[model samples]
Target: MSDRALIPLLSAIALTAIIAACLVGSTTMSPGRLLAAMVGAGGAGDAIVLWEIRLPRAIAAFVVGAALGLCGAALQGLLRNPLAEPGVLGVSACASLGATLALFYGAAALSPIAVPVAAISGALAATALLAFAAIHTSSVITLILIGFGLSSFAGALMALLLNLAPNPFTLSDLISWTLGSVANRSFDDILLAAPFMIVGLVFIVLSRRALSALSLGEEAAHGLGVDLPRARGFVILGTGLVTGAAVSIAGAIGFIGIMAPHLVRPLVGYDPARTLAPSAILGGVILVLADIGVRLIPSPAELRLGVVAALIGAPAFVWIAIGRGRTHG
Candidate 1:
């Protein structure tokens, strides 16, 4: 489909997904009741359930997914690699490490703001290191290897924190955060992360033209008047802000970034520039649906959102890897 047509289709799908998500929680409500609750015409209990519980959770899921999707598309374009993702590149790991440290020391108890700040710090550190490496070497293979090393190191640190947990409750909280979820999130959490997400998204949008030029290779892009350094700066900063803020709020949800863009690329004629918005919308849809699915599945307890995403994403990752290997081979 053309960009114009594809955009409306994606928007409609996103709207449908959001509405479905709002309706399908542990305490299910009909569409009429949901609308009534939204507009303050429903009972007090229903209002609290819909407004305070489901609405915030659904919105958080969408925001987190949109951030990841946009970052993934931008990173794929910037790195010119299909496998590029926040998790694959260790950015999410680094942010998780930061959040883990805060939780480990009980900073979260002291202040809700501490975790996100620390996460952002870790993300910026990782992105800066990656930017430095990119300047010194242009090999995608090298970058991927470096990312793997960083992820491994961060994982080790997380393990250490877990081993030294002061109590079972702290340990459990740490585990849950690492696993990721949007349940029980409040509007305050959304308010905290929105500014960073907005800034990151704006940076990505501003660099769309440059990202398109980048698909043609560095030298060719330079010849086409693309300022490689500035473009890279925007992408790195944008990715750091979005990914870090997302990790802070939702823990380390993975694969939506990689999956969303890949799903939408063909619809947008494979144009990197056109892929960003669609990927974001689809990402929101995917996460909202996943959140709803977790609620509906029969279990002793609801599944972690991150775990569900990983279960679905890991197979997709392997399939993509195999296909790419075949294409290259």
Candidate 2:
């Protein structure tokens, strides 16, 4: 199918997955019950389950996945590197690290919003750093390396926190933040993320034309009057916002960003600009399905969504890395 057809089809699939998410929880709502709940006519229990629990979780999962996917597509386009992703910028790690600190310090006991607030702050800090670098530095490699340093430092700090954990419970909580989840989310969480997500999305949208131009080659793009530095700033800032927002909501869900664009690019004939929406849709579907699988697992403690994502995404990441390396070499 063409890009137009493919996008709508992916969107339909995403919708189906989200609906499945709403209907396949522990209570297993029937279509009729789901409809009634949508219209606010279901039983009180059903409404609570669907509206407060399932629907919020499903939407949060979609929003997180879409953010990562859009960031991945735009990053890959900007860098002209297939291996690029939001995590490549270290914003996701920094965000998670912030949340880990909150969990470590017991801020979560004070308020549910504390962890998310910390995570988003961390991500914005990364964005500010990257934005400054984009303005001052001419090389993309410098930005990537700086991100690597940030990620490495953040990972080390997280490890230290894990090691210095005062108790098993604290350790487990810290680890869980890394493992990631959207369980027990509510509309309040979504509302909190909306503004940041919108800002991030706008940055990416504004960078799309520059991304398309850069795909031809930096010199050719410059000839076409693409403001490379400005584009880089927008892409980096956008990526930081969405990535932080995603990690805040879902606690460092991994690989969807890289996986989404890679899977969709072939279908879209590898047009960076055309890849964003389809990648986002596929990313949402992937996460929803992963969460569904998490629900279906027979394990006693319920599989963490990040665990499932890593299980699926890590292999794909390696495979894609290999493919890109060989093609480029």
- Candidate 2: where are CA atoms >4 Å away? 102-117, 124-149, 167-169
lDDT of 2 at 182: 88
Give the alpha carbon lDDT tens digit for every residue of 128-239 in model 2: 7866775577566687788788878888998999999999988887887778898988899888778888998999899888988988987899999999888878887788
TM-scores for all candidates: the values are 0.96, 0.90
Give the distance in Å from residue 179's predicted Cα in candidate 1 to where it truly belongs.
0.7
Error of 1 at 280 (Å): 0.9
Model 1, backbone clash pairs (residues 3+ apart or across chains), number: 0
Q: Could you give candidate 1's per-residue lDDT for residues 188-285 as a string of tens digits? A: 99898888888888888999999899889889999999998999999999989899999988988888988999899988888899999999888888
lDDT top scorer? 1
Clashes of 2: 0
